[model samples]
Target chain A: MLSYLPIQLIPILPIKMNYRQAKTGKLLIDILPNKCDFCGCCVGVCPEDAIELKEAEIYIIDPRCTNCAKCIWSCPIEVIKFNKEGVLEK
Target chain B: MKEEYDIIVVGAGPAGSIAARYAAQNGAFVLVLEKDRDVGYPVRCGEAISREGLEAFIKPDKRWINAEITKFGFVAPNGKKVVINLGKVEGYMLERRIFDYELAKTASVAGAEILTRAYVNDLIKENGKVAGVKFEFRGEQKQIKCKIVIGADGVESRVGRWAGLETHIDFRDMESCFQVTASNVKCDQDALFFYFGKEVAPEGYFWVFPKGKGTANIGLGVSGGVGKKRSALSYLNNNLENFFPTANILTQVAGGVPSVVALEKMAAPGIMLVGDAARQVNPLSGGGISSGMIGASIAGRLAAQSIKNNDLNYINNYHKEWKKLRGKKHDFLDKIKDGLFNFTDEQFNNLIESMLKLPEKKRTVGRFFMIALKNKPSLLKEIAKVFVV
Candidate 1:
């Protein structure tokens, strides 16, 4: 039941906005916020050091993330995926 | 909660709790900070631990045990199964949520102050040495100063990086893993099962650790590099039906296992890293509960001694003591794991077939490893050092 609770109980001031909406034609990734359990596998597998798992939230450095898709598979729950909007725009 | 203490331990997992317990028992003022609202939640492990490894620290309590394990089963890619009866209870499938809370309770009973929902933001350094920590608790920013800082944070630890330790893990040295606690699952409650080969786990292994009669934790870990070609989830999803056809999923959790023996350095001036933060999990098995607690016990005791003697050198003893305890064996295990990474499915099938030929009583994990590594005499010799004891 604890895993089902949303982690973002406190409003986290967005440090870096996910650029999928603002910028297009570039590969970007997003996560299903509720599905993730904060396992940190994505953070450990990212070769570019693009993902960071804070206690309350996950941050993907948009510039550093290259749509490598490593994090996509590293995830156990398949919460992370390539942004559909970004892909369509491209 | 205090302005100053003898030691500030980050995280309240098994390692942190053990570290804090020992530190407090040794007469050091200790404070433990946990970012989660509770001590253990959102479990991220398969939760099987060897009985011998655990008894060395605390008595096994039924309150935290899910199942008593006595048999081990290994399934090759070709579907050959080799079952080894350990002859007695050898391990336990734990309820980690309760187990972790009990450990932290023991630490608290030993006089260590514990704060939940205390998110550590950064290390407070003075003149190039760790002196304390900056943390947020209950929506309030606070700083606590201490003589020594112990990093027991799990896989995503930043304390080591903040203290300038070379804690970066090569992707190959990490296991991208995920697990699901499912009900209506059928597995031997008294045995632990492992499935191997490329089709099963892709350079790692699939595990079914039964928690009770009809429930189990089923998971798989793939070499971090496999993410480039396929994800671990895909592999598990594809195979889960064949293994547990009636499984009704309950909860899903994903985590990384640092498949290395230990970091190059685990201690710096006024600081020590324990458990996953220091890569203390066994390389071959990816099991950390016992090893992490052992390392934490050493770190906790040493943190107290170093502060008592007013000597930072005592902290370095934790690294050396850990090597003597299990670090050396883990190093050899890492090498064996590297050899396993290249093993073809045919090899795994052959290995299991050979094990099946032996008398069931002789089909122990040691004998299986011997046959598996017969091709590499040097590695086999190194492994003999572990089993010979």
Candidate 2:
């Protein structure tokens, strides 16, 4: 009888975790402004269409980015990287 | 902005200008939109082209010619050099800033309207077909209708993606590149030098293309996705002093070159992609100026013909025609590039050393490649497939 209880009655906490948030809570991809030469290498290889090269600024759209690290690999000057608490690494 | 045009070209580079020129010349009302404030500011190219390639479009001008390359130099990891004297000017390093402007001017003379500082952000579709463009100019949004849209926007082209063409490339096929135009540089004035080694470029090559009068474009391209510990620019910076100790760096650029045979699909109804947008660059040499121009010329002419005839078939001919014109050669070269670039550092040192054995007159470019291929039977077989026929 207990097993037959309605499933809707059981309150379940919604588990919402994106792949990026699951891996590292601090998976932040940003460009090192001074080192970025503004060549569109990052824009070309982005699978998610996350990077944008404006007049003199490059923006990585947060919601669009899956943080696949393709832009990180495409950069020739190593300007784009994952920022973990003010420290940047691969 | 005009409300309508027969054809619209995006990005105003060599490919866009040439496309607009040809389309307009063929009686199409053409419009070209350039995002840059100027035609060719903030140059990202190495600016090297063969003599035959440049002469095919416009007459060579003194104002735009930076250096007339008459020789070639190859440097191995061991610092050995092999120079090929072509006996006459067979290539030119262009002053791209002026050259690109001249190209756009040529298109304008051909009766195409051009707008600079106009950024195209979206493609307007009608009946599930690309029919127009929406752009931003002077802080205002503008939309224009067109019968055909040519995506000549370079490597980072968004036009291709927006039009639903598969323009994404494998990381291995993209050359992560950095280049600098420097003054007071020490290098050959009439020759282009290529430096090869894993430590130097890592699955790529370094180049010193002379721009005359103690000026040169020093650059390097490394194959992408190799997961190299250091960046291409970092590698260039580490070894730049060795090549040019007294170099005074003036301008620096970072970019990517798509080193593929060609994209699988470059065209859709009412739209076509040309130049780097189509990945029309040579796989081995990574040069695209001439190829892009050749492709745009075909695309422009066909786009006009398609609109004139009211037949979509003419537009698709661009892919077939371009393949016959340059695509086959690119496929052959792509195989050779993979085979040649995989040589170990010692193999490169030996290959350069072997070139010394041949007489100076016998050491032509053909002979140089023949000797390089003799050691690798796989590459020899690949060559036989082309020439043995």
Find the candidate with the highest TM-score and give its number: 2
Evaluate model 2: give its lDDT. 0.85
> What is the DockQ (computed on Cα atoms) for candidate 2?
0.41
TM-score of chain B of each: 0.96, 0.97
In order, candidate lDDTs are 0.85, 0.85
- Give me the TM-scores for chain A across all models, comma-separated: 0.63, 0.61
Best by lDDT: 2
Q: What is the TM-score of each candidate against the true structure?
A: 0.88, 0.91
- Per-residue error for A26 in candidate 2, Å, reads 7.0
Per-residue lDDT of model 1, residues B203-227, tens digit only? 7999999999699999999876786
Model 2 residue B389 lDDT score: 43
Among these predicted structures, which one has the highest DockQ?
2
Tell me the TM-score of candidate 2's A chain.
0.61
Candidate 2, residues B219-287, lDDT tens digits: the string is 998877653466888879867877788899999988889888888888998899999999989888999
Model 2, docking class: acceptable
